[model samples]
Target: MNLKFLYFVIFMLCLGQNLRAQYVEKEEEEKITTLYPEAVFDSIQAKKALALGKGKITGVAFTKTAPLAPRIYADNMKIMLFPVTPYFEAWYKLRNSKENLRKRRYVYMSDAAFRYRLEAISNSVGKFTFPDMKPGKYFLTGNMSWSSTGSYNEHTGTSYGSYGTQADHYEKRYYTQNHEERLEKFVEVKTDGEIVEVKLK
Candidate 1:
């Protein structure tokens, strides 16, 4: 082949390769965009089921005094659902204290005491949801607290007889205050997939 013809063929081949690569990259990008839509759609359908009263609980948890407490949206604050039984109710009554039910640790107590639990974190607006729960009586609890600690040092100096001074001594004192609140209620779920509202006060 002549030099010009060979060069033209090589250029055409390079152009085809570039076009193929660009097409593949575009396909990959399109695929990524299309991915995960089904999951999102499924979640929307589940929420619709909740709206139709499909054994789901959804509501906002807030204090009665001020509905917009920062702790209401805190990540450590949680909404817990436990089956309502005599034993579970008694256990909740006994362990219900500021010290025991503070932040996320409130949900960490003896799980053996209850048959099972379903929990959800409060969103930025203090909204929580428990989807697809069984039809039965359930006990719900929500608690949150904020605490601050401070320390101070005290110095005491004494002078001995005639210009004699004793060494200086200091004592440190520390204090902490935990402001917390707890809300509890018993709810029943119907078999026909009913949405139940359990608001924490």
Candidate 2:
């Protein structure tokens, strides 16, 4: 073969190999993001995995007003498992700030760090499970709200004086107070693969 043709063929082969390597690297990165989305935003979980271990956490959330009484099921409850990190602590503080109330209108909406935290919804029977969590301190929280309606009577009085005589008129108005009752709890998880029971009041 001519030297020119040989050089052209070698260049083509090298280009193909380079393209293949790029494709493989991209695929591996995408897979990691899919499995551990938080790794893209922060290295906390990755560092924890390297230092400690990973395991599963399962539990149930219920409400019990009276002791020894059958607990009320808290179905479809949202449970969050947040790693104990400075980022998480700051987020928690921001979440509870009155000045940021307008910004935090949606409880489900969160940043990448918070969103990647392990989360689960309780089943019909109030059972929830979070599997494959890195071994570390995790802040557990759950919230559930129900609609409530109540009625109250308001009284209004007016007085008038004319011709040295006083007269008063009174009125009563009935009002309905429609509000929501929210149940929430904050707990700490110290062990992995251990069941943590949370009671909401």
Candidate 3:
């Protein structure tokens, strides 16, 4: 019976090795992002780290069409929080600042990459909270868009009469265009119980 038990133990060890090999192959086949070719997805690490600490993130999401435009609150808007892993670090570098982000508006990540994220919705006043977060660096993102319509007066040439030239005049011109505001920020939680407040505009 001792010899039989030894053979069973060896078979189980071989089976475990086979399972580990399959898992590694599966991870190798996963899709990757071209923005940061050196980045490898680490969903397990992100999730584990995200669940280890006790923290919270509170912020308000607001935006404007232009410098002189009115402040628009992101009412009932969605907010995404991602751990600053390698994949997200690459993404953040691509649009690190407002100027860089505005210039490269089409940069995107791979859809199939492993992503560990949390979500929340802003209230009517654009206030949102992500509680029970771990101590680490994170990325906060929100988007607001709408179409604005307005009218203005423009000076045109003199109107022509039936047989003679008429007087000069101004015409009312209407304009409408789509406007989008993207808010991206990085926040850190230093302790287990900390709150990071941000104005996510």
Candidate 4:
């Protein structure tokens, strides 16, 4: 192949790759403005209604977990759970005044409501909101559980059994114990808010 033509082809390939990268970046920016079904509060009235009857107007928040190294957008942030579940109770945790997390905050939703015949899962899942947050932060963390309970006496444990002769006793045991209300895994989020809108090509 001619040297000039070969160099030109190589240059074009590099150019195409660069364009693809730019396209990806542009796409990410567009996602920032995109809206989720439950996240969308198209009108002021709708926004007001959701906040109404709800205790203390705590802000809403959301995070995207997929697309590994997920792209985060301010617009993708949601103030409400898309689909509410009565099986759990959700709450927010702000930074204590003397805490190192004064600027950083968290929220949790535990499953430990026993009053209504509910045995809350041991873990609690939470969404975080930041009224004053620094930009360029990549991830957020929290935890979740399938159930929870507050009563201490309700704690339960397992029992064991044995078989065979006393001289040669073979024993077996089962783990049927339930633990006290304890926190679980910490989930990290890349974005703190909603995704911004983009100009469609």
Best by TM-score: 3
Task: Name the regions of candidate 4 deviating beyond 4 angstroms.
Answer: 1-143, 147-168, 177-201
| Candidate 4 structure, TM-score to reference | 0.16
Kindly list the per-residue Cα lDDT of model 1 for residues 1-201, writing each as its tens digit. Answer: 899999999999999888777444334432111111111123333233224235788877766435553433433578777765555545555455455345322322343433356678887667888887767777778776656578998886644656675667778989997768777777888775788886665
Error of 3 at 155 (Å): 6.2
Per-model TM-score on C-alpha atoms: 0.45, 0.45, 0.65, 0.16
Residues 17-76 of candidate 4 have per-residue lDDT tens digits of 887774343344321222112222233432332232212212222223355644222232
Scored by CA lDDT, what does every candidate get? 0.62, 0.58, 0.78, 0.28
lDDT per residue as tens, model 2, 62-150: 76546996776667878776675655555556556675564443233235565555668988777887666545666667665433344
For residue 160, model 1's alpha carbon misses the true position, in angstroms, by: 38
Which wins on TM-score, candidate 2 or candidate 3? 3
- Sort all candidates by lDDT, best to worst: 3, 1, 2, 4
Model 3, global lDDT: 0.78
Stretches off by above 4 angstroms in model 1 are 1-53, 66-76, 92-111, 146-178
TM-score of structure candidate 1: 0.45
Where model 3 places Cα greater than 4 Å from the true spot, the runs are 1-36, 65-69, 94-114, 154-165
